[model samples]
Target: MLHYSRTCGTFTGMKANGTDVRPWLAALVIGVTGIAFGACDRRGADDEQVAAVEVAASWRSIAEGVRGDRIRRDAEMLADDAMAGREAGTEGFDLAASFVAERFAALGLAPLSDGSYLQEVELFWTRLLPESARITLQAGDTEIDLTIREDFVRSGGFGPGEERVDAEVVFAGHGIAAPEYEHDDFAGIDPAGVILVVLSGAPPHFETDLRAYYSSSTVKQTEAASRGALGLLVVRTPVDQRRRPWDRYLPGVGRTDMEWVDSGGVPFGGYPELAGSAVLSQGAAERLFELAGRDLSELFVHHGAGETGSFPLGVSAVLERSSDQGRTVSANVVGILAGDDPRLRDEYVVYTAHLDHLGTLDDGDDQIHNGFYDNAVGVATLLEVARAMTKLPVPPRRSILFVALTAEEKGLLGSSFFAQNPPVPIERIVANLNIDMPFLGFPIGDVEAFGVEHSTLRSSVEKAAHAAGIVLSPDSMPERVRFVRSDQFSFVQRGIPALNLKPGSISTDDSFDGPAMLADFLDNHYHRSSDAGDQPFSESGAERFARTALLTGLWVASDKDRPSWNEGDFFGEKFATGRVAPVSAP
Candidate 1:
């Protein structure tokens, strides 16, 4: 029996619970299970090192085996041309479901819920058309009238009931409220019902990462609703700057660049630094700003930021007025691998990866963003994990489930639905190990355990990594916002610990080849057609990744106790200090 003890909330369990039982026992299990699995090789390495050469040596072969044979096979099939763009609620998303279902069948994986694998998610499509959008910003006698689409792109204004609505535009400088910063955009102004025209993104007026403030359509939606406005019209500011141009794109959960998302090729999502707010052509934006007696820089710096004020944007629009608003139904694929241990099996370990991306583009490029690297790799590796485990020396003690969510790119819709209305009671879940863009390059060194800051799941990740001789990436990338960016956030919201593991990164301030390689992509292939190609396979990296994950699954699967959050982390506090999970206010 394994002996275990907990110190500072960290659990320690050796093959014999730290006793000399291991000395007399023959090394049979180590040879068969530990050594063959890379368990011995990666025992200890400094934080500064990348490849746990000795550690990697332990599991390289099996990890590579899982990657090359199993993971690659599944990836190829799922990313096949037949799946189309796999847009949420589309025929393609459904087709991909069958493909995944069939793969599960082939792998001999069992159903997770009531012996049935499918979990239907209901989705609604809202299309909007702009009947009227007349906004004129005037300085004295000069009035500038702006039309829609040609001058700006408006997805129908979200408001209660109305055949049509229009409100005068008011320049409500940054619509933000941060008490710590002593800033208040709505301090003295109340532009209710009218269109609240605020500058999109932060300007020089703010300190801190600008991308965190206004990088998505959500902030606009959130603020508009919060301020009790009829609609929100965001004015673009030239103040935005990023390391690269495409950095402006919100690699939002399932979002892709070329209309459709191809998961197989993309790298991890860094916050879009470039200007992501709606870009109104130069001429049109200037005309509107001129009315406020502000030029590009001044308005962006002083008048831009935040989502408050009673300014009406004089904005009216609809969603599907264009040909692109077609609708379809998609699903959330759920599969289960039953645990052999009755008690542990009742406690579930959740696995999730987004399966939707930008469908297709207009330039006659019918190619789907198969999302191979973006998430297909995560999903594929997950499938491979299921395969390896089901063939385990003995079935795991806990249940392992697979979920491929839809519309992650469209604001994490499917996962949100799951989080909101879980098929099983949410509390029964132990932890969620989410997979996303796994193949930027095999982690030559340590894996980036993204939410390592959040939960005890991080400890499981690190221990498994250490057993394999790999170190966890050095620190939390608060700027990277890994917690809020992935579907893991949803699970975290419900009090289940979530772990997001990066394939692994090398040490040296960064990986030796990482920076140059990323610069190359950001400059050239980041979102171009060049990303999709049949390149020579390097088994070393893939094996390292799978083996590490295999160990994590095994560790989490074997233990009777479910993983929890570390006490100090934000998510941990929410659960421990407050028995009830916190949610968006009513």
Candidate 2:
């Protein structure tokens, strides 16, 4: 018979004589006692020990496979001086693509297309000849000459010829014409053959979707051109300068501009009716209002509050620009991991990271903008996720596509091409998980998921973060319009549920200052050459991030039903077709 004392940690068996039995008899008695107690003593301990060992081993394997050392190594290699900053359409970027392809191949992922990992993207590269670019504001007898890249910068995508405009200037408020918002900047005003000066941002109270979509320069330019405007002058406000600093815009003054070429091999046309467009500095913009005897500050206050009105500014502006355009071909590197379930193998979950950076800056002493933190880290994380997914004990239910996109810095052109001209059927693409510039300067306690709330993929993201013992946070800087900034926006435009992950501002413990660290990165290193390989890096944080992304993707791929956009969601209503109603949050 077995006897156990609840107060003690040991179990004992005693014979009928109440004396110690022989060794063989004791062993047999113990075995019989364990069975009699329903194995609560011996079997329970063994089972618990085995289960603990397995769990520990499983996490240990994941940690080891997605280690910081490997991630840092890959980042350093990609951002190395030899890579020349991996500019799109340049040899350096091609080298980076080849490196990603090799890594994908090594991880057992097959080429996305037939025997090739490259998706050729035709591009037109344009650069403005600064000496030939000019914009002069003529008010009465005063003529203020604005220098290129100083007081104003010529906008890209203009046709390859000289364009001159001399017309009356009109203040067109936010320059938006949205009937849905009951707003029209051109209403009751004739902008015909006049240079239209518009604010850079939309009204603050406008709907998020309406604001984001209409605030884009393309939309603004298109609207102005459609209204028969002679030229467009975008006036930068304090808010605009805060969102993107003047110094950041200064670097790309005369740099190469890239855009995707149409399938017909013809370049997309710029606004033909508009003679030219220039982004005027705040100082230069205020001058226009001063010449017109109007307070730009008061105008900003009124427009921001959605009470904007258009009026002629009693001033004329002269603009001229010449461009030296050329053509180049770039490629988006793509790889595929086939799914285990035969029925779901055709459907895919995509992971994207941009592989191109600013390349070599002409003005900086250190010409190479290594982009280590900007995106080399992102691509490295993607590779690590690929490696971890390939090592999963069981394959995912849906296929996984890994894309190292190009020309993201140029304006998400590479991703735009892939989303439109996918190697697989577009319907087969279910979701997109984009990793871009995740600010891994400290041990991240939480992650900020952009666009997660718009789709059912939020459930998978939540589960993944919870499994990793991390919190998931929403976009803290919604004003930045980050959801429309990166490559994920391209996928979203095509009705795919997409999300981008970044280290959050919240810290788990008092030991780290998360928001401050991120602010410092954005302030000091964000598009500059300072974002080089030698910058401070948190490898552990990067590994954690990679794991979080990998788990999120795996969960989505293995889900029985495809992730869907929330019904009536702004993004879904505007972009997706056949959307699903929102489900309860996980």
Candidate 3:
């Protein structure tokens, strides 16, 4: 009695076609005959039939209940001016937490903490005092002063109080010591008690995997510290400056940096060996090289060609820096939906999304960075999924924990804290599904799942996507290393199977340019005040994404077997213990 149509390469059905209707009619007739014949002796059969009906009804309700309007409304509420960007450790973030908690309570989900919905995270906040910062380069008879926030920016991760260092400068190529790759920058050089100057990234000609791993600032700093370096001066090349302009770093010049406090209530000692570190602007770096009678561009050319050498620049530098430190409290909002099977109910499947964004900026008239697409939409998707789960007729086999993590913008600190100190046993958490920023500007045909290649959960995600009439795609931007950048990485580091989802480039309509749209957002709106609530968005895409996520979580939670990392997977073999022996890589 209903019609169907195909529009823009997508199918829409109002009623079953003749081929589909015949099977349903036959099944109904068979069911009716069985019920009539067995009613006198099969009382349990009636109960089974009623339960089956309830299950079907519940599925229909969920499929219809997840609507676009609701998702948009929730996103607008979270991204409104009243939330003030929802930055962690501020009143705005507190308000956002309260809203999430209230929604959880209304949905009839239980609190994860002991009689509370919040997991309080104690953190140390530190900010550099630029006025008290000083740096000078002395080459022969000339002394040049570098201005803070203009020529150089002080790096975080140092303890409170001032540190003054006066040491000779040594140029260390790439500043990496990778024994695995038979590479060591400090092969014959003793950088003891000196200021080690290094380039920003690895050798341009190195293999991609090795380059990415060694190019991390953390690895470089640890290497420099091990070599007994007193301080680090990272010189920015012209290419680096072009990639990230100096103006982009100005907003964070005096902004607070946060790190989680350990269980013993002591401040976490992070990279304690390095006394001071700073990033030099391109101009400052050129001037330093000019003093040494060398061209900065030539050094870059040599490094790009995989040249490795160390030299004394005949320059001595002194750096004096101070920081203001304090402690603050932020919370991860957690709620739980209990499962059905008594034995499996203790195990958990976590759904995580960050609830924080970049706060107000001081330089612009429009200061509040309303992160509507960056994360408000993600949280909205999470809430809608939770609502749908609450309406299910039968609960999953494993418990579901919905967590809105805080301080994710601050290096996934909140998720890290939770993973280290969980409300439930760490080993009992089976899997994690993290939603960070889902692009909802247009309808997408495929979904990208980061970290899918590392675990058996790929099978589960594929099944869910098939059920939703959607296709699964691998991470399109592996160069971004997105898997290790989000909250899911914290769970992965704890040896749990996790994946982050987003819409992929492939779309249902020719009018939608998904890749270009994504690039535009990253270039123009990401972490900017322009990412406000008023921006145009596609609620249909958001609703579809939420549905896919909900189905994926359901499949994982209901399965009898626990999800595990595939044998010989890089993350599994490195992080997990007491597991199967790793097989040879294919």
Candidate 4:
């Protein structure tokens, strides 16, 4: 007979003779004892507490398989200079893909239908020539010439050509058309044959997920194209400028853009109807407003005051740009851990971490933009989590698919492609757990999960966080619109319940400034050469995150019921296939 007790907040096993066992030994003993007792009825809270302790002990034992040293080793190798930043479609990216495939194979994970771990992704690449791009604004007799990459940058998602558009300009407030919200930016104006200049983000009063959807460039451009607009111009307001300064975009002036293609070779996200499009700097936008004798600041104030107004700017812009476009093939490294239970083996719980980053800069002291924290760490965590899963005494009821996706830095293309063209039946895929750039330099006491509010996955996330002895906090920077920024959004777009977990600002060590560390990485090292793997890292933090994610996936896979979206949820109603009334959240 065995008993359990807590000493100094650590569970320990007590023998019938009243002897205390070491924590590790206690966990092993309790795990075996609980398995032997098997299915016991939950008579009361005492049984619940006992069951919880047993789960925590088992999870802790499994988590030990995810070693900090191994994670660091893998991350350093992936972010090595030889990988050339692992940009998709490049040889460097292929090397990184091979590395992940090799790791997956070593763990005894099975490959996809191709009989190999690599799943080829077809992509259409477009690199805009900033030097050749031209933009000129005409206001009566005055013609204002704007410099490329300074005043504006041509937007991607357009086909290759000397594309040009010269037409009258219209100021469309927010450029969103949501009938549910009773909002339409083009209520009074006809978008036909006109260039629509719109604000960058949606209204602040909108719900979080709704705001993210309306604020995205793809949605805005799609709205413009559907309305027969000749072109589109996105301008950020003072609020948006403060959050993400325009100058930050200068470093990526001429970055290559890409979109995944279909079987017929047609690009997935190209909007050919809008012949021209560009993102304007605040200064250029101010100049345009000045030319129209209107205060852009006043318009911003009106927008903040909940006034959605549209008007003709009484000005016109001539936009032209050329791009070097072609087709290339990248691969998403996929490996599956087949479930043991015949009842749920067909259903899968997917784990994704992007394996691509910015390749290299043409003119820079350190050309390699090693994405050490941006995603090398993410892929490392994925590998470690997969390894930990394999160490479980009993496999999850549902199959687990560990996918190292490519081209996430290129606008979530790889995940998007996979969501569209899944390895198994799409409906059988239950949930997505994404890891991207988790804080690895501090003692993490808590974690923030994006996109957990709208689905039943929240319960499992909370349980996992509790089992890992960490707090699950709300998103720290909601203004950043992170819910739609990562690979998880690709799965969310297909109505799959998904969440992206990252270490929160709260730190276990009071002496350390966690927020400052996060801010420094975002401002100084993000997308820069300084993001090298050699930088100091906290292995404990990595281990904690991996454990939390591992437990979350395990809980979801073992549950008898499939995860579902919250009732009347925005994303669920909009994207879920065969849209039905969703089950309410627990």
**Between the candidate structures 1 and 3, which one is better when assessed by TM-score?**
3
- Per-candidate Cα lDDT values, in order, are 0.53, 0.78, 0.76, 0.81
If scored against the real structure, what TM-score would every candidate get?
A: 0.72, 0.86, 0.84, 0.90
After superposing candidate 4 on the true structure, give the runs of residues whose Cα lies further than 4 Å from its correct spot.
1-58, 155-157, 362-364, 577-586
**Number of the top-ranking candidate, with TM-score as the measure:** 4
Query: Which 10-residue window in model 1 sums to the lowest lDDT?
Result: 2-11
By descending lDDT, how would the candidates be arranged? 4, 2, 3, 1
Tens-digit lDDT string for candidate 1 (448-480): 766666566665677665544455664334444
Worst 10 residues of 4 by lDDT: 1-10
Can you write out model 2's per-residue Cα lDDT over 291-337, one digit (the tens) per residue?
Answer: 89999999988888888699998888888877777789999999899
Q: What tens digits encode model 4's per-residue C-alpha lDDT throughout 1-586?
A: 1112112222222343455454333433343333212122212212433344554455657765567788888999999999999999999999999999988999999999879999899999887777878889999999999998779877543565567789999999889988778888899999988999998888878887788889988888888988899888888878889877877777677788888989988888877777768889999999999998889999888876556899999999898878778889998999999987788888899999999999897535689988998899999999999998887777877899999999999889999999999999888888999999886887576788999899999988876665555658899888888899999999998889899988887666656677888888887787789889866688777776787788789878877788998888888888885833332222
**How many pairs of residues collide in each model?**
51, 0, 0, 0
- Where does the lowest 10-residue lDDT sum fall in candidate 3? 1-10
As for model 4, its CA RMSD to the true structure in angstroms is 6.4
**Highest lDDT: which candidate?**
4
Question: Residue 574 lDDT in model 4?
Answer: 84
Q: Which stretches of candidate 3 lie over 4 Å from their true place?
A: 1-64, 155-158, 203-213, 226-228, 236-240, 292-295, 305-314, 578-586
